[model samples]
Target: MNLSFSKLFFVLAFVFGLFAVMVIAKSVLIPLSMALLVSFILFPVVQKLEAWGVNRLLAAFLSLLMMFLILTGFLTLFSTQIMNFSDQIAGFTGKIMDTLSEVIVYINGNINFIEDLNREELIEEGISWLQASSGTLLQSTFSTTATLFTGIFTTIIFTFLILIYRDGLTKAFVSFGEVENQDRIFRMLQKIQRVGKQYLSGMFILILILGFANSIGLLLIGIDNPFLFGFLAALLSIVPFVGTTIGAVIPVLYAFMSSDSLWVPVAVVIWFWAIQVIESNFLNPKIVGSSLNVNALVAILSLLVGAAVWGVAGMILFLPFASILKVICEEFDQLKPIAMLISNDISGDEKKAAKNSMWIEKVKGWFK
Candidate 1:
């Protein structure tokens, strides 16, 4: 019993230490994680090129080139849409301020507790605040944009290298384990690679399907930039639960701003909500079902922890990490219980018995 306690303590301490390292080294780690996932996705392409009599380095380069072209196309489209959105924002600023002034005046008129407030003075003060903050906002935006580009550049480099040296890496990993364990390790690695590849490919198909579905809905509702808004929302849905809401809010808010009728924005909201339902019910289950297989509660907690540790990149990276962990846990006899706890497969009586035993042990320990 004492041995078990010590082992549990060691496990918990290791997990905490690992999280601390991830948080501290996120600048480097996040890019490497991104690259690792990308390498999995591109591995097949590299293999196919090599099978066609291409040299190893050339095959890796070709795969990277293909990825670069796809990214370039996506960025070109997004940048064009963003420039248009910025132009609209620039044109609408005066109207937005006017609307804000009216709102402040209306609120002041309705509330007797805030009788000290002057509408014109409030408007003047608000504008002054905006002007003062604009410089700081711009500076931060530039800084963030630079960091984003740097991360992308590093990820691209790392991905190419990983593709070029994947076999060597696999051999290195296998060499560290026992000879009898080597086969198991190789099998685990293959499963991990397969999961990574399938998860990404499934996500891409889901995005395409959801994007099309959303575009149709928005078009039917007569929303401007249907394709752009739809695809953007679909891409954001990659982040899980919160992503759909954030994605939906963007175009809904845009609809409110650009349209004169209240009904247009209302329709926009209803449309996105409906699409979200379809995505949650039909699209995700069909495309990405059981691939990660993480419990909903555990997944949400991981996402929050990831966001706290590495910001947006963490949110994206952690789900796959959870999947990798699940794979690892399943491969080891002693960690089977952990795999069950983190996994979505909780309906079994065996899992229930294990969980109950765990809780009862903790309860018994409290008195000691």
Candidate 2:
């Protein structure tokens, strides 16, 4: 009984400690998380520039400039479309309300078996809740926006400093007093660098493919702001599971609102569905491989927990961070069990099977 009680107490304490860490991470760790993600994304470009005979500092600066320009250009190009989409929300809400009313009327007229549905009461309650929550929600949104802006600024500064002094940083990590410790640190850094570069590069390629596919589909379906929708889709695709679905809803809803025919929205949905299926089954395996090997369930859970902890930034950073943890765990024999639990190694044959499956799919795709 004493041992059982102690174990229970320990579990409860651990849970509370995790919650406290998450809360503290929102303010204290978010910027550093963002910085790490940015650094990972930029690392490959800097390395490529270095390979082409540029100095590390110059290469890093150029890579940073390029990233900033790309971001600025995307925002500039899509600003009007985003504004228009936001402006149409009131109309969309009204239309959805009307649709709900029509559905309720249809149900009441057709099914006399269930008369007391209380649709009106439900609608009223929903509206009342929305009204009550809107002010607080808006205030919370603005606060979050301010925090995000500050975090981004800090991340940018941190990323620039890290990149500028990357060589010195590496040297410092590798110059520990003990040779074994120095070697271990250097190896760890190398592993992290390789994993980070591969993850970022694979993600970039996947996003680019998704963006182009989405744009073409939207265009073919006669959507108004195809480019903007594609951009949004690409951005959201960084997040796992729900991201693609959320991305689809925007374009489909836009189609519903703008187009007179219901078929447009239906087509948009089908298009997104097909694209997502292809991405999941084919593209992801080809691009990302089983190197980072995080399990889908863990990835989704990490995304949710990260979002809860640090909002969108956390959601964006969570997967790679989790992947890094898995890598670290895998590198140490004592921690390999935990790594296996988190990784996509359910059958122990995952790596070999994934490679074979990827090649098969690639061959099929090429022939088709």
Candidate with top lDDT is 1
Off by over 4 Å in 1: 1-5, 113-116, 346-368
lDDT of 1 by residue, 118-227 (tens): 76787788789989999999999999999999999999899988998899999999898999999999999999999899889989999999889888988999887788
For each candidate, give its TM-score against the true structure. 0.91, 0.76
Residue 272's lDDT within candidate 1 is 88
Query: Who wins the TM-score comparison?
Result: 1
Off by over 4 Å in 2: 1-19, 44-61, 83-97, 100-141, 165-178, 289-291, 346-368
Give the per-residue lDDT of model 2 (tens digit) for 1-368. Answer: 12356656786999799878878766657777667767877887888999999988788889989999998997898899888878877667656665686688678878864566666775776678778999999999999889778878888888888887877988987885367677676778878777777877898889889999999989888888798898688778887777888999988878887778999999999999999999889988678755567888878888998788777767877888788888777656555555756778655487867755654554344223
Give the Å error, residue 183, model 2.
1.2
Q: For model 2, what is the alpha-carbon lDDT of residue 39?
A: 88
